[model samples]
Target: MATGDEFPLPGSTYRGPAPHFARFRAEQPVVRVPATGGGHAWLVTRYDDVRAVLNDVRFSRAASYAPDAPRFPGLFQAPPGMIISLDPPDHTRLRTLVAQAFSVERIEGMRPRVAQLVDELLDRADSEAVTAPVDLLGRFTFPLALTVIAELLGVPSEDQERFSVWIRQFAAVDGPEDEAIAAREQLGEYMAGLVVGKTAEPGDDVLSALVRARIGEDRLDVGELIGLGYTLLGAGGDSTACQLASSVVTLLARERDTWVRLGEHPEEVPAAVEELLRWVNLPTNDTSGLPRITVEDVEIGGVTIPAGDAVFVSITSANRDEAVFGSPDELDFARGGEHLAFGHGIHQCLGAPLARIELVLALRELTRRFPAARLAVAEQELRWQPADMNHRLLELPIDLHGKGF
Candidate 1:
């Protein structure tokens, strides 16, 4: 069995590629690792193997609730009716209701608004004038993400600061175990209250839609409603926040040719955003050892994952697998849509549409406005949260053209 010390969690520290993950993927694509909560699990890293485990019904997501199921102590548990934690039938039904809210057409409708938000942020960045030091993570990515998600959920604009505070505490990577638990409960209560208010006066927001919708008299209860809110905050906010910052930083770090090329072809923003998603691969550690207990024996990559065993899928490694992606480490905007940043199978990220819209708008606007932008600081001097879960930069001091775009 691999000891807890053998495999470092995704975001533990940034020392090039994760040593444990690299080693494990090389020697053993699937191996047992000591669970954070207890027992052990089989961590799957290869591209094909990870996809198989994700799509396999014999591997149950609901198994996380089993009496002896192993899981991280403070990780948020999906309430009943929340699609993330459910398997078939119920999962299919619950997901369908929210699916329309994130459809291609619905997300496309938000493009102009998303572009406006991006323009506003970039305008602020330019207002500072000169090559002023700015925290892209805080000033640009976080606000943009928070604003979009708040609007989508119909959260009051004035209350966003409060919502942000709750999210910070709720998603803190390092905290006392009890503190994380307390934060979760407090955030849940807050969401519960918000849901109640939305129910009383239904609005045109996603939350209201969820509250008013029904499936044969079955609807989201308070807990599940709050859980959905939490999911949006985490997925809809944090993931995009990190990715936006990382994309900006990565783009500027490259030759001026890349920025010029992108700016010249703004229509390629969608493809560029796809490349960014694959390249940055945030939330790598977010799915840490979130094992799906096997309902029956299964063979993957020639290895047998026995029944009742916990199977962990590593999204980060899978995206970089040599067998699947050519020159896997290189970033190519034209690589098309072969990556698994949104995951695979039924449980793929529901917020993917929103995330794509955010990235496309942000990147297009940034490049168009600050075509000459370049990193003012050395790559080695940049700071990041000490984990693979968030691909973010604490600050992105840049020198841009004096004239704002």
Candidate 2:
């Protein structure tokens, strides 16, 4: 396989994923490339090849996290006990323990609460917008995502503001290395305390459940508990927050008809949300969804990746694969099929159900409230978060345009 551009590439909020992803998907499904952080590894762009890599056990997440593992230059290493760094059956065991909290029943149970939160947030947006355009990323999306996850995890509502600061730094892709490290350490310490508090005064929230959750005879140790907290904050809060902001921007600014369509047919909002998730490629620099290392020689897309090689699967590109979704770049809610936005296989996003609920509710309410919402600033003038693996808007400044009613 030929080598492509350096991984991580440069962070560009104004632009989307590298155009080379399309070219590579059309030509070389798999190729090696210099990692943005430092080292070089295989970059897989095709939808089929990416799905194969994610589903294949030969491509090991554990090996990718090994101390002696090949790394993508400057990427932050996963701390011990973080579930994302673990391999099965450890991963399976840990996932099983927390899976109940995110079960279909539990997430479904959250709909009313989530909708209420969205309504309150939009109310606040309206109040704030009386003077000027409100930045939804801060005023609505970030708070909504973080608050929901915090409430689920038993984090104090008052502390969410503080937690958000640390999480943003920790999740930033272009932030200083020292600041990120500091943020992680600080957040870890905070989670440790939070877990202990929950253990002592166990509540009805997810973290309390996790603190006491068991898989037969085993339970999460303190380290694992802390790690899980970290995961939830970063994954549930950070990623989903970005997704929410991007969804609003994409729907309102780029796909206004889709927005109008959903507003007209509220029943189709769920399917529309899925399509938006697939089509909106926030500014991303992480070529791979998360770097995986080949446990052995594995052939993907006719190219063999030997054991110990870091492989990055381009999910953004896969979601846009022309083979799977004709006219891949277009956002057609009616044109739906399986997409890898939430990934596939064992490590598929654990919070997908919650994210879907949040997005659906947010879209339903936003369309109901502000069908005419439009960007207050030019699309080109908007800035994006320089986050690693995150494609978040720095702020979604928008005018509500006097609400839908």
Candidate 3:
């Protein structure tokens, strides 16, 4: 490795980006590492470089699938019809058509229902904790995230259990590559049937909204629609579930004062959620972010990455950049500032608005309703999934009743 950094670079995951990333940001902001297939890929860690890579059109997301592209070998690219794979005009068109469903009005209108769901989940947790440690991931975060996205996408309740399984399979890094690919296909197939049904009988939901969406003579084909639907479920649902659950774990374990204080002033919950998003390091198996293939020789952080190379931009590191955040590693809810938690540029998360709403509402409710909540077990005792995949506590056991043993 050009930086002498091994894969899964060494660092404590306690606060953010681990310690090694901070060193890379200072010493080798842009360094090369062994690529998955066979070649080398540049790792961009500085906030400025990370943003530059994201904003520069020369770094192409679509090119990542080229047979000869330098990339991590397994699952080198998103399936063709997925939005994450598209670059400019194609990405622009699809996003325009679908963006209406995630608009401010639509997402805000969902607040009441989201609040209701959160309360219901916490109700279960509160009751169950009277007897035993309640698995907060299962009881609160997972279902709230999955249910909201499912209803938004107009997936029938009967079909949603399968949706969760498919998403988990797709998100698992330890699982066989073939199984993950199969899960993607199955999810796509399921979404194909959903589009047909929604097309025939429109519902007041995102998929139906997309079904009716058009541009002049342009409309999304079945493949594009299926791809978008599954993308929302897989990326939106699974990642949000992971982030929200992990945020909760951080609060109960690390920032118990902030956790209790936020409950006292529910209005501060949104700001607190923002800090958590910036602070929590979503554990992954790689030293890379989503890979973008260089369309031309690009200079980021004073390093020249040649054309046809894969560039891995670290959003985690960028969010923790010292130049951008004062005392960058410390989780300061009061220090409101821009961060790359949702990423940057056109490829930024489309479901970000909905996710913010979900996180804000869920946290607000939890803090208010169960202000005495505490971890039932030591932080190390929390069962995290294999580090090969995204690190998420498999189950978060909490004492929701304020009675800690």
Q: Using Cα atoms with residue i matched to residue i, what is each candidate's TM-score against the true structure?
A: 0.89, 0.94, 0.95
Query: Candidate 1: misplaced stretches above 4 Å?
Result: 1-5, 9-27, 35-39, 72-81, 284-289, 387-389, 402-405
Q: Which of 1 and 3 is ahead in TM-score?
A: 3
Per-residue C-alpha lDDT of model 1 across residues 310-342, encoded as one tens digit per residue: 777877787778777787778777887588888
Which residue pairs of candidate 1 clash? 11-387, 11-388
TM-score between model 2 and native = 0.94
Please give the TM-score that candidate 3 achieves against the real structure.
Answer: 0.95
RMSD of each: 3.2, 2.5, 2.0
Instruction: Give, for candidate 1, the lowest lDDT window spanning 10 residues.
Output: 7-16
Model 2: runs farther than 4 Å from truth?
Answer: 1-4, 10-16, 286-288, 402-405
Best by TM-score: 3
Candidate 3, clashing residue pairs? none
Runs of candidate 3 with Cα error greater than 4 angstroms are: 1-5, 8-14, 74-77, 283-288
**Reference-based lDDT, residue 12, model 3:** 35
